[model samples]
Target: MNSPLPPLEAPTQSAMPEAMNPSPDRVYIGFDLGGTKMMAAVFDAEFNILSRRRRKTRGNEGQKAGLERIGETIDLALEEAKVTHDRLAAIGVGCPGPLDLDKGIIFDAPNLGWKNVAIREFLEKRYNSPARIANDVDAGVYGEYSFGAGKGARCVLGVFPGTGIGGGCVYEGKIIRGTKSSCMEIGHVQVLRDGPRCGCGLRGCVEGVASRLAISAAAAAAVYRGQAPKLAALVGTDLKEIRSSALAEAIKEGDTVIEEIIKDACKHIGVAVGAVIHLLSPDVIVLGGGLVEAMPKLFVGEVKDAARKNVMDTYRDTFKVVAAKLGDDATALGAAAWAVASLQPA
Candidate 1:
């Protein structure tokens, strides 16, 4: 996900301290590109936030427009930080995949309706800095490992269940990656022989069975059958509005149908976590994203219990599953750290 920079054309000690600015400048930028939104952040060498900008993805506007918005957001962030391209050391992006990381090309991002985007090249050319791309969840977990809940853990497995279930693993200090792309597509790991269709167009993947989309689909069916009166009264069959907090509200209202839907979703997730435990034997499994943020105890407790039951006796007590702690800043910080470390000196 990185290319050699053209070399630092100019280095100024006034804007960038000598030690921290060896490669170019002390400033680093990180961009988090999600299905629904894109965000950019500027950070000092110590990872202090200088500025941040966020905007809707507008992906339906197509690839060209989407890229334009991303660039604009980055410029806005840098401007607000009172920094310019001259101060930039490197840039990193957290994007959806399966991607060709070596070429910085996104193979496909179903949520963004994108294909084969040369993201790293675009950023490097525009900002004149070395740039790297990483899977969004991979970046998130790395952030946590570096500064949040998974800090100090030698092996960390992250499962972030939102619109879909995204998984990541950081072993030792490295975010596991294939030669061409980031590895650990845990979401696509088969959980059911025949189940829901996934975003990736596969059948019975853990994502299709355990994600927010799956929960929403179940809630919709319940509302249609008049089995979830509280949920119906709250969101009125609008799946978009049935986000994590809404589901929590429904559960608090004691809606049996909604509760069942949630339980089923958790069961699938637990199964997947159990499998990951046996395969990776991570020191910690960090459960994150919108759903876990909304109902941390319910989601984490359920998944942990089921996963424990599924694992072999010797492995059952090995890893602890916990919630993510870094919130919105995790991906950005992780990306910046990855970029700064991966990029070469001038």
Candidate 2:
């Protein structure tokens, strides 16, 4: 291979005189619909964000209002970008989903009280551009792979532990989707037998044991028993207010009970990730979400240690485990990039 072997020249008039005026800089819209918040963002061709908008999901208002919020958020983001809807090339949404991807219909998202919603059609009709959808974690992982932590790796597996543990993988530069549907619900994979019930009505799942909700429940119980005075003093007994930041503070104050709870959760996540590694053998395993961000070293240490213990010795050092780098923008950023990739000619 040659390095720095040639210098480029501008296009000749007879060859391509109209190249610059052929098209506008394509801008894409991305929406991240989660249990607690809904965020919309606008991205230039290179995925640099131009503008964004955010609001609570308020799912109790029902699907109609939720759908309206999606549109409104996107509209406001586009307005901030100073890009009219007509100039929009495409749009994508990353939502809590087990979607019918071919039709872009979300099957169920209990967090949002949404069922069988045709999101792609709605976005396309409203914005007059093409649209696509993916599970929020799926979008997030892809975003990291394309532009953040996992970049340049041949394969990337992402596990995000938040309200739930969501997962996704980018293999050989393409998002992995099953023949029948978009799979990879890593959070719902079983971690314990006959354990606590999950939101999906399943027992002993990873989400039931190690997700933020699970940690919050354990903290609430500890506070009720007067075992976690620091957490109680910091956030009260309300599980909703016991966020990762509060947990981090409790840990900073040397709350053994809270640290043990989070460590246990990280171990469960590691077991699940280990299983993923044994099956997929991805080059990189990226951990993201608010929990990991707030307490990164702890999460990284516990997860990598557990994963190392669970995997075969030969496969031990082949994968690097790290925390997500893009922070909150990953899901929305990935959705926009995925939309742009989908629109390109094969």
Q: Which candidate achieves the best TM-score against the true structure?
A: 1
lDDT tens digits by residue: candidate 1, 230-331: 888888888888888888898899888787787788888888888988888998999999999998998888889888988999998999989999899999
**Local distance difference test, each candidate:** 0.85, 0.85
lDDT of 2: 0.85
Q: Which stretches of candidate 1 lie over 4 Å from their true place?
A: 1-20, 23-25, 344-346
Residue 127 miss distance in model 2 (angstroms) = 2.4
Off by over 4 Å in 2: 1-24
lDDT of 2 by residue, 23-63 (tens): 46878888898888999999876678999999888988988
For model 1 the TM-score comes to 0.88
* Per-candidate RMSD, Å: 6.2, 8.1
* Ten-residue region with minimum lDDT total, candidate 1: 12-21
Number of clashes recorded per candidate: 0, 0
